[model samples]
Target chain A: MRIVALAGGIGGARFLRGLLAVTPSSEITVIGNTGDDISLYGLRVCPDLDTVMYTLGGGINEEQGWGRQKESYVVKEELAAYGVEPQWFGLGDRDFATHIVRTQMIDAGYPLSAVTEALCARWEPGVRLIPMSDDRTETHVVISDEQGRRAVHFQEWWVRLRASVPAEQIILVGADEAKPAPGVLQAIADADVVILPPSNPVVSIGTILQIKGIREALEAKTVVGVSPIVGGAPVRGMADACLTAIGVDTTAQAVLELYGSPLMDGWLVAEEDAGTALDGVLVEARPLIMHDVESAGAIAQAALDLATEIAARRGTAPQGEDAR
Target chain B: MRIVALAGGIGGARFLRGLLAVTPSSEITVIGNTGDDISLYGLRVCPDLDTVMYTLGGGINEEQGWGRQKESYVVKEELAAYGVEPQWFGLGDRDFATHIVRTQMIDAGYPLSAVTEALCARWEPGVRLIPMSDDRTETHVVISDEQGRRAVHFQEWWVRLRASVPAEQIILVGADEAKPAPGVLQAIADADVVILPPSNPVVSIGTILQIKGIREALEAKTVVGVSPIVGGAPVRGMADACLTAIGVDTTAQAVLELYGSPLMDGWLVAEEDAGTALDGVLVEARPLIMHDVESAGAIAQAALDLATEIAARRGTAPQGEDAR
Candidate 1:
C-alpha cells in the first residue's frame, strides 16, 4: 500500500527501516523532520534526514543507529585542535561529505527540498524522503538552569545537554510560516495510509504536523500512529522529557489523547499498556519493543492491520492488498 | 633582523622554514600569496597560507611538501562517492578543519585577513602570517586544448592538468581591485631587508606584486630576492611553465631582469649561474639548493649578507643588526 511516514532521528529512522522491511520500497514516502537541522561549522547537517538515509541505504552504523558505518573522527579531532566551538556534536569524516555536498547545493540557491532530493540520489534511500518544509524551521527548547532561562537550538538541547535540564517550553520557531515541502501534501493525499513511526512526538512528527496544511491533510486521511511512548516511558530517545515539556503524562493513552481522535484513526500501544482506551480512536496493544528488524516489521504490520480494520468498520474499502 | 618575506605555497613555505631557522621568530613577517586560494565545496582553501602555516607549525607532510602529516582521505573518498566535481584536488581530513573554521568565520562577516590571523592563533606559526589581500584575487591560466583557448582556475591547470598544456597567458583575475591585506605594506615599510624566498616568481611572488600598492612599497625598500631558478631550471614546482607563459626565459638573470632594477635592489643566483648579471642591482652567487632545513638556512643567511653589502655600497646604515 502507498504509505507516507513521518520520521525524526534514530528512533524514527530505525522504525522506518522496519517499515521498509515489510513494505514495498516504491510505496513509501518519508517526510523527515528538519526542525533539528543545524549548520555546524558552516555546513548544513540534517541529522534526522541523514539517519534515515544512511539506515535505509546500508551506510548507517548499526550499533549507534546513526552516523556512517566505518566512520572516522579525524575531522572532528582537527576541529577541536583549532578550538572551534560546539565540540560535543560529533560529525564523522564520512558523514561530513554528505553535509558538504548538501551545503554546497544549498549555497548555490537550491532550496532544502531540492537539496534533499539531490542527496538522496546518491543513497537511493529506497523511499522518497522529503524534508518537512523547504524553509528554515528550527525547534528551540527553553530551559531554566542555575544561571537563568535561555533558549537553545534543538540539537544543543538534545545532543549537547542530553536533555538533562527540564524543558520549560518547546518552540517551533519557523513552523507557523513553513509550507509543506513539494510532494508532501501530494504524498499525503495519494497515500492509502499515513504512519507516524516511533519518532519524537514533540520534535519530529509533531513538528511536521506544525507545518501549514500537513495536519489538515492527515485529518482527512486514515492515519495510524505507533506510540513512541511504549508504556510509562519512551521506546527510544528523550520522548518522556519532551512529553513532559508539553505537560502530557508519559503514557500511551495520554499521548493518543494529545494527538487527539480527530487526527488519529488508530493508535498502537505496547502490550504493557494493554487495555488503555482512547475515546474515538481504535486502540490496539501490540509488541512495540522493536528489538530487531523482524520485531520492527511486526510492529509496522500491526499498525497497517489496525488501519485496515478501521477502514472496514467505517464501511470503506481497504486499499491494503489491492494497492500492493 | 626585522624581515618581511613574500611567499607562495610549497617552495615558498620550505624557504620560510629555512628563513625561520636563521632568523628570530619575532622579527619576521610573512606576506603569503592568496591568488591560489579557491573555494571547494563552499569552504575556502588557502593553499599558500596553509602550506606556510602547516610547515612552520610542525603539521606539514614533509614527504609531500604539503598538507597535514598522517592525514586521512575519508572525506575526499566520500565526496567522490557523492559525485562531487574537481576530484583531483586532495584535501585531507585534518586539512578540512582549517577550511571549515575559515569558511565559518568568513560567512560570519570576518574579513579574510582577520580569519587568517585567527587561524594562525591556533597554529602559532611564529612569524606574522598575512595574506597578500583580504579581497578575492584568483590566478587564472589561459590555455588552449582540444576544447579551444579558455582561461581556467589556476588549480585546474596546475593540479588537474599538471601544467602539461602550455599556458598562453597567466592572469591574476582580481588583482587590479585588490588591496594588500592589513600589515602587508606596513611590514615592508618597517623592514630591515625584504626577502623574496625561492617561491614561484610568476604565480607566487608575482601575484603579490600585482596587488595595488605592494610592488611600490617594496620598490622603496632594500629588497633582496633569492632565485627560484637554479641552472636555468626551477628548483621546485612549475615555475618554468609560468615564466614561459609570460615570455620570460627560465634563467636567474632573465628572472632578475623581469623584476627589473627599480624593484629588485639585490639578487642571489646559484653558483652555476654565477656570471648572470642585472644592471643597477647587486648580484651575488651562492649554493641555492634547499635540500634540507640547514641548507635553506644557509641560503637565507646569504640573502641577508647580500642586503648588508648593498647597504654598505649605498652609504646607508643597514637596519639588519639594529632591527635584530
Candidate 2:
C-alpha cells in the first residue's frame, strides 16, 4: 500500500519503526514536522527528521529514543567552555555530523527538501522522508515568568524549560508564508492511506497542518491517527503541556475531537479509552502502549486495518486487497 | 617592552608561548595569519589564530603542537560516515566548538577580527590576538600533475597533498582587497620592537605583509625575525616547500635576503649558519632549535636582545633602559 505518515520526534520515529516492520518501507513516505527545527551554533538541526532517520537507519540510541548511538559530548562540552548560549540543548558529536552536512548543503543553495534527500542518500532511511516545508516555519511558545512575557523558540521552551511554565500560546511563525516542500502534496494525493503517528497533536502534526494547503490536502484523504494520549496522559514527551496550551484536555477523545471529523476518518485510542464516541469518524479502542517493537507493530497494523475498513465503507479500498 | 609579533600556526604558536614566558603577556600583541583560514562544513576554521590561542591558554596538544590537549575525532568520523568531502582535514570534536562559535559570530555580522577577540576572551590567551585581515584572504597554491596547473586551497595542498607536489606558484587570493584588521596597524606603530615568529614566511608572515601598508609599517619600526629554517631545512612544518614555491631556497641566508634590508632591521639564524651576512641589517647567529619551553624562551630572549642592539645603533633604544 502507498502510505504517507506524519511524524514528530521520538514517539513518531518509534512508531514509524513499528510501521516499517508491518509494511514495506519502500511504500512509505514520511512527512516529517519541521516546526521543531532549530539552528544551533550556526548549524541547522532538524531534531524530528534526524530522530526518524537515525531510528530507521539503525543509528539511533535505543535507550534515549533520540540522538545517535555511542554519541560523545566533547563538542557540547567545548561549546559550553566557549560560553555559547542555549547550552541546555544536548547535541552530541555523532549527531553534529548530520547537522553539519545538512547546513553545508543548505548554505550551498539547496533547499532543505533537496538537502534531506541528499542526506537520506547516506542513511538510506528505509522510507522516503520529506520535510513539511522548505521555508522557515518555527514554532514559538509564549510564556510569562520572572523573565516576563515573550515568545521563545520551541526548542528553548521544550528542551530548556522542560515545558515547566504554562504556555500562554503556541505560534506557528512563518507558517502562513510556507509552501509545502516539493512532493508533499503529491505524497498525500497519491497515498492509499495517511497515518498520523503518535506525535504531538498541537505542536508536531498540528504545526505541519498550519502550513498552507497541508490541512486541505489531508482533509481529502482517508486519515487514521494513533493517539499519543492514552488514558488522559501522553505516552512520551510533554505533549500534555502542549495540549493544555491549546486549551485541549489530555484525553485521546479530546485530541481526536481537536483534529475534528473533517480531517480524521478513523481514530485509534488505547483499550483504557474504549467506548469513546466521535461524530462522523470510525473510533476503535486497542492496546496503544508501544512497550516494544512488537507492540508498536501491532498498533500500526490496527491503524492500517481501520484505514482499510474506512476505505471499504467509502467503496475505495486499497487496490489488490479484500476488505475484511 | 611593548611588542608586536607576527605568527602563523604551530611554529608561531610555540614561539609565542616562549615569548610569553620571557616577556609579560600584557605587553605583547600577536598578529596572526588568516591566509590559512578555510570554511569546512559551513564553519570558519582559523588555524593560525586558534593555534596561538590554544597554545598560550594551556589547551593545546603539546605532542601534536596543535588542537586541544585531549581531542576526540568523533565529529570527524561521523562526518566521514555521512560521506562529506574533504575528509583529509582533521577537525577534532573539541576544535569544532571553536569554529561553531566563530561561524555563528561571523554570521551574526561580526568581522573575523572581532570574532577572534571574542574567542580569545574565553581562552584568555594573555596576549591580545588579532587576525591579519578582517577580509577573506585565502592562500591558494598552484600545482601541476594529471590535473594540470590549477590553484587549490592552501589546506588542500598542505593537508591533503602533504605539499608533496611541487608548487608552481602561491597566490594570496584576496590580499589586494583586504584591509588589516582593527588594532593590527596600531599595534605595530606603537610597538617598541616587532618580532617575526618562526612562521612560514611565504604563506604566514608574507601573506600578512601583502596587506596594504603593513610592510611599510614594519619597515619604519625596529623589526627582528627568527629564521624558521635551521641547517638548511624548516624547523617544523612545510616552510621549505612554501619558500621553494616562491623561488627562495630553504636556507636562513636565502630567507633573510628574501625579506631584504628594507623590512629586516635584524635577522636571527642558527649557530650552523654563523657566517650568514646581510648588508644594512644586523644578522645574529644563535641556537634556533626550540627544543622545549626553556629553549624557546631563550630564543625569544635572543631575538629581543638583537632588536635592542639594533635600536641602540639607530639611537632608538626603548626609554628607561640601556642596551645590553
Alpha carbon lDDT of each predicted model: 0.90, 0.90
Candidate with the greatest DockQ versus the true structure? 1
Q: Over the stretch A1-324, how does candidate 2's per-residue lDDT look in tens digits? A: 788999999999989988888875338899999998998888999999999999999899999999999988998998898888878999999999899899999999999999999888888878999999999889999999998999999999998899999999999999889999999999999988899999999999898889899999999999999999988899998999999999999999899989987999999999999877788799999889898888888899999999989888888786434223
**Residue-wise C-alpha lDDT for candidate 2, range B1-324, written one tens digit per residue:** 688999999999988888888876337899999998999988899999999999999999999988998898998998898788889999999999999899999999999989998888888998999899899989999999898889999999999999999999999999889999999999999988889998998999899889998999999888899999999999999999999899999999998998887899889999998888888889899889898989998899898899888877887776433224
Against the native complex, each candidate's DockQ, computed on alpha carbons, is 0.93, 0.90
lDDT for each residue of candidate 1 in B1-324, tens digit (9 for 90 to 100): 688999999988888888888876438899999999999998999999999999999999999999999999999999999999879999999999999999999999999999999989988988999999999999999999999989999999999999999999999998889999888889889988999998999999999999999999999999999999999999998999999999999999899988887899999999999998877789999899989999998888888888888888898856645332
Per-residue lDDT of candidate 1, residues A179-259 (tens digit): 999999999999989899888888998899899999999999999999988769998789999999999998988888888
Off by over 4 Å in 2: A320-324, B320-324
Which segments of model 1 are wrong by more than 4 Å?
A320-324, B320-324
Candidate 2 backbone collisions, by pair:
none
Instruction: Report how far residue A161 has shifted in candidate 1, in Å.
Output: 1.4
